[model samples]
Each structure stands twice: as structure tokens, then as C-alpha cells.
Target: MARAVELATVLGSDRVDQALGLAATAGRFADDDLVSILEHIAASKPVGEIVRADEAHSVQSGTIVWQALGQQPTAARESTGD
Candidate 1:
């Protein structure tokens, strides 16, 4: 289609080709689907980025402590001899 050629001209064939493949796989065939997919592809940053505590925040305990959560809420509960 003429619009695909126009998009390819403006955005480059490789990007368009890749987006087209993704669109086909996702079953998106509406008129604006290409542009929508391209915009989503471009706007790749998560709408909200959550910085994990282990990433560099010194005040938060790191992930290793999280692994201990599976055992129970606390060892103190088990040690109570119930």
C-alpha cells in the first residue's frame, strides 16, 4: 500500500519491516495500527519505572533478605514452640 511505502520512506524500511512483522503476529490490521505499534515501540520506557531497592538505594534492605520471606513471617513465630 502507498501508506506503507510512505512510512518506510520516513521511518526506514528495517524498522517498518520489523513492526509489520510484529503487527502480523499480533493480528493488528487496522489503518492506524502501524503507527500505534511504532509509537509503542518507540515509547519503550515503562510508563512508571520502579527502582528496585537493590538497584542502589542504601536505606532499603537488599534482595537476599527477601529470599528469607518464604520460610515464614518470622523465625520468632516458629521459635515460640506452638
Candidate 2:
């Protein structure tokens, strides 16, 4: 829960929405759970310094937390073969 809030704080609404969708579609969580997380996100404000210092860390840690809660792996980005 705390992890999710921290994640939403750093990553903002769009990415958090994506995470929620992934979790829901994976059957890991229900609509109520997603709503609760979204509420937390809506109530949160990002601390600029903290966000700057640990955005990547927040995302990584949040990924682990979400996976533990049964979130599906996101689709890998296709390389352009550059």
C-alpha cells in the first residue's frame, strides 16, 4: 500500500493507471483494490527532491511490490533495431 502510494507519487497518474490495469487484468486484484490505490494516489503529492533522487528506485521497488501482489509482467518494448 505504502509502496503503491510512493510509486504513484513519483510516477504520476498515467503509469499508476497502467499498473492498476495490468494488475486487474491479471486477476491479481479487484476493482475495489484498484480504486483504493487510486484514492491513495489522488491524495498524494510528490516531494520534488525525493522524486528526483529516487524515481527509478521507486519504479523498481514498486514493480517488485506489484509483482508480489500478482501483477502481470508488462509487455516488453520492441526495439527498432537501431
lDDT of each: 0.79, 0.61
Tell me the tens digit of each residue's lDDT in model 2 across 16-62. 76668767676757556666666665576752534444655553544
Identify the leading candidate in terms of TM-score.
1
In terms of lDDT, the poorest run of 10 residues in model 1 is 53-62
Stretches of candidate 1 off by over 4 Å are 45-82
Steric collisions counted per model: 0, 0
lDDT for predicted candidate 1 compared with the true structure: 0.79
Candidate 2, superposed: residue stretches over 4 Å from native: 29-82
Q: Poorest 10 consecutive residues of model 2 by lDDT?
A: 72-81
Displacement of the residue 10 alpha carbon in candidate 2, Å = 0.9
